[model samples]
Target: MTKTLPLRSYQFFLSIIFLLFSAPLLAQDEGEEEKPKLTLGGALRFNYNLSSWKDGQKDRGGDFGYDMFRINAVGTYKNIFLNVEYRLYSEAFGGGFLKQGWMGYKFNEEDQIQVGLTQVPFGLQQYNSHNWFFNLTYYVGLEDDHDMGIKYIHDSERIQYQLAFFKNAEELQFGSTSEIDPSRYSYDIAGRNKEINQFNGKFIYKLGKDRNHQLGTSVQYGGIYNLDTKETGDHHGFAFHYEYLGEKWNVKAQGMIVDHNPITPDTISDNVLQFGAYGGTYGVAADFNLYSLAVSRSIPVEIGPISNLEFYNDFGFMDKAEDDFEDSFMNVTGVLITAGKVYTYIDYAAGYNHSWLGGNYVDDFSAGNPDAKWEARFNINIGYYF
Candidate 1:
């Protein structure tokens, strides 16, 4: 069956497109436009890990391996601009894929529109956490998610807002396949159900003497199409967040609720949904509430090769809606060291019923073990960017 956006959403999207082309022309300045410019850069990263669950690896010291290499490009001409990033990883880790690619037009200094694969504009901008692993929100496709969409952003002195509509998640192929493709960067619904016709809105208000304090909220709604049944379901998420950026200290806090209702066959339980990324697919609780808090402090150091140090602790908890389902928890204590073009992250991450930490990949977030023990991993990631 053919998929389409809701009538109201379709109309709204067209209206924005109309404005994108028409409004920018009127807003152009009379002076000569700036010359076009393009910049290219990339990074190489490696990792070392020691896991409590892996006895053999722990006994043999630890495993150090290649993580990933990524290329980034940004270009601009007049009011049109483009940004793209492609990543290459080991075949065991999702091979290679486009992380993000988008072309945008500036209506003015304070307003702009982006088209193609772009960020959903939910939660905090750029990132909600200071660590490499991020918060629990990242696991469930709520953080740093990109999709095929159009987004409008307004940046002002005291307030900022964004609205976006995503037609679907990134597609690796044109037609339906027997199995979900897991070779991608961002997590999304990838089993029998697919994400489509999603809408997101976010607003932020800045306060404090130096405008160092920011409070924001985000909301998302979308369709979940079950390929087997040829039926479309729905999902929605809501979040409220706050951030404080001090001279050398930073704090971030957020609370969110997510619900996924997919129209699957009767044999499959609706209490869980399947999500995939990084060359694997796993189950996630269909309905849950998550809370996250992170704090960080930066210190200028005079070490031979280290110029600065950032210490941080990030904590997140997920409470499932089903009474019998066990909760999930994660905490990461780490320090980031910066020296020239090289950066290193040293982290001790622990989790209970968490996917990457210690829990079973298939059922940890769905029908989690009530008696599961906490799992921990000591990891160090080093990357050089140019």
Candidate 2:
């Protein structure tokens, strides 16, 4: 429902009256004898891929020709959170809005306040990890690209802060055409049919003597309507980041910028799409237990160079940055190796334009399939925890 005016419609009806009075504070206070403590959980993931191309031919490994599928779920209490996702990405339209959802709220211990539909923070390993359905540009579980509205956060020990607002994740990937490499890269991202609005903010710090070696920053702004421009011309986004998180050794660096305008309307346009582009990246991950069998390796400068050798004790990873429709500049990378729980390992990548192919992968969507190359994925799952 994105058609002119109503900018934030009075803060979207005051956050729907605080979610209808926060639904009676989720009931259960009563005399308050330290009862209201809840923590339930759920998670499942499945994935597959097969690649082959022809049509025009050049893109050696993939261009939406092969095959794919995925399923996901998540839930948390205390601060309040819930999420679900499903996909059968056979490639092409990428996956055609399968099923993805998110809800959140958690304003303390630092701070937090959430809305609905999620993803699209593009860093800190996609916000904590999940591997954006195989790193499809692993901005970390990918653009996680979901939309609805409202989000705020603050965390401390050193410090970190976040802010968000949305209305469209209508298939996050900036434009729409799902171009992993369109001949010479491409983007015309338009496929919301209204409901596009966004805002994002982030900060993190740790200066003096070893605060786990840290420094971070982020800012995102959004809007992409274009009811023939009467929607006051939407389409715009900006991002910047820096990182260094350590326990055993971890490092990351980031960048992003986009602005979509000029009579933008879904289903490809801009004559063939090409709005804005900027990129930067650097990555390093290290953790080894060996006495208990734990391993890891990462070289991220835009998807390329990955190594994981694990028997497992525990391991984790994340990455996020997205704007599909092939406008160029994407991020996603993920890894999880856990042995304490039977067995586990996962990986995915869809990143390129690390300021300009620093690690290379998407080489112009095959230029019509010039024996295309660049389609990666890996998954291994075994579980428990009730």
Candidate 3:
């Protein structure tokens, strides 16, 4: 069912890129008003983990290790702006990757466009979860997903809209014959099937006296090209989300339906597809319905260096289309502590038929075991931001 990008759309993307690059020259002709400003910031983080599934680690108390070090740069020159973030992690966790790098141009106070490896306009703007481990949607490439694309954004007092066209996922090596690269920051189709020519659109409306309530919907469609068959298939998804922000409480809820029809070889099953990220590849159900809800309450206190505390619980469930496939579930109950430049997350995360939480590595999200036991992990992540 996958279709090629239309000729007109292709030309439109090119035109937008041309305009984005030519804006500075046009601004110079009109006379520059202010100088460009650049800012640099970064964070260093560490983690301690105790897993009920790992007997050795439990016997030794736990394991503490370096988590991540990231650098971010932001610059603006009149109507033109740039944002870039790169991260470094342990070798086992995708050594390093460019999280996001995009250049943008503001058409006016309400409209702007960005081109580069930009975050996709999908469910939830920045993230769907407040914890260090995001919701299950992230594992399936729905939450906090980014791609090489051009995006247009419109922001008003009560309405927000976004549209984007991504030619493909980020390529670490150009013209490489390898079909899969596990060393990445975001999950994507990385086996014999590859994602390409994706389009996304999202709209949000704010209500309430303070405009603190938001209701949004998003849709995405893309081609999945199978290297073995050399035929492009298709994948699509739709999401409905709502959020409410109060003085001391926040709530987010979302529902999504995702389907993938990859034209694979006869030997491979289409019920599950391969997804890769963080230096590993795993199987994910091709068709599933996902639902997630998160709630948090913030409390202010003066305790030594700690200034505030936020407690939250994020829960997600995945129901596969295949009748025999076992469902997946995850929940993270955590508290975030803020102390000046330092922040810490203490969480007890549990999962059933989930990949990262427990169960078999590659098959957990695919043909999950019906009798899989619940696995839990106690984790603490501390980070210093500057």
> Which candidate leads in lDDT?
3
The local distance difference test score of each candidate is: 0.90, 0.40, 0.92
In TM-score terms, candidate 3 sits at 0.97
Report how far residue 250 has shifted in candidate 3, in Å: 0.9
TM-score of 1: 0.95
lDDT of candidate 1 over 1-386, digit per residue (tens): 34446588899988877876776577678786788899999999999999999989999998999999999999988888899999999998899999999988987789889988898888876777888898888998888989998999999989999989998888877686444577878889888888989989999999998989999999999898888888888899999999998999999999999999888889989889889999999999999999999999999999998999999999999999999999999999999999999999999999999989876878898888988999999999999998
- Alpha carbon lDDT of residue 138, candidate 3? 92
Where does candidate 3 have its weakest 10-residue lDDT segment? 172-181
C-alpha TM-scores of all predictions: 0.95, 0.30, 0.97
Which stretches in model 3 have alpha-carbon errors above 4 Å? 27-29
Residue 351, candidate 3: C-alpha displacement in angstroms? 0.4
- List, residue by residue over 1-386, the lDDT tens digit for candidate 2: 43343646557748754863485477436564442443444333333332222223234432222233444566665456666555443334343343446666555567656556555453443532233332212321123344456666677878777776665544344444332221111122322223355566667776656776556655554554544534544544444544454444454444444434434546534422321111111221111000001122433232222233232112222122222312222233445544333223444433232222223333231111223243433333433322
> Which rank order by lDDT, best down to worst?
3, 1, 2
Alpha-carbon shift of residue 3 in model 3 (angstroms) = 3.3
Top TM-score model: 3
What would the per-residue lDDT of candidate 3 be over residues 1-386, giving only the tens digit for each residue?
44576799889889888888887677675554788999999999999999988989989999999999999999998888999999999999989999899999988899999999999999987999999998888998888888999999999999999999998888776654567677888899888888989999999999999999999999999999988787889999999999998998999999999999999889989889999999999999999999999999999999999999999999999999999999999999999999999999999999999999877988899889988999999999999999
Task: State, as a TM-score between 0 and 1, how close model 2 is to the true structure.
Answer: 0.30
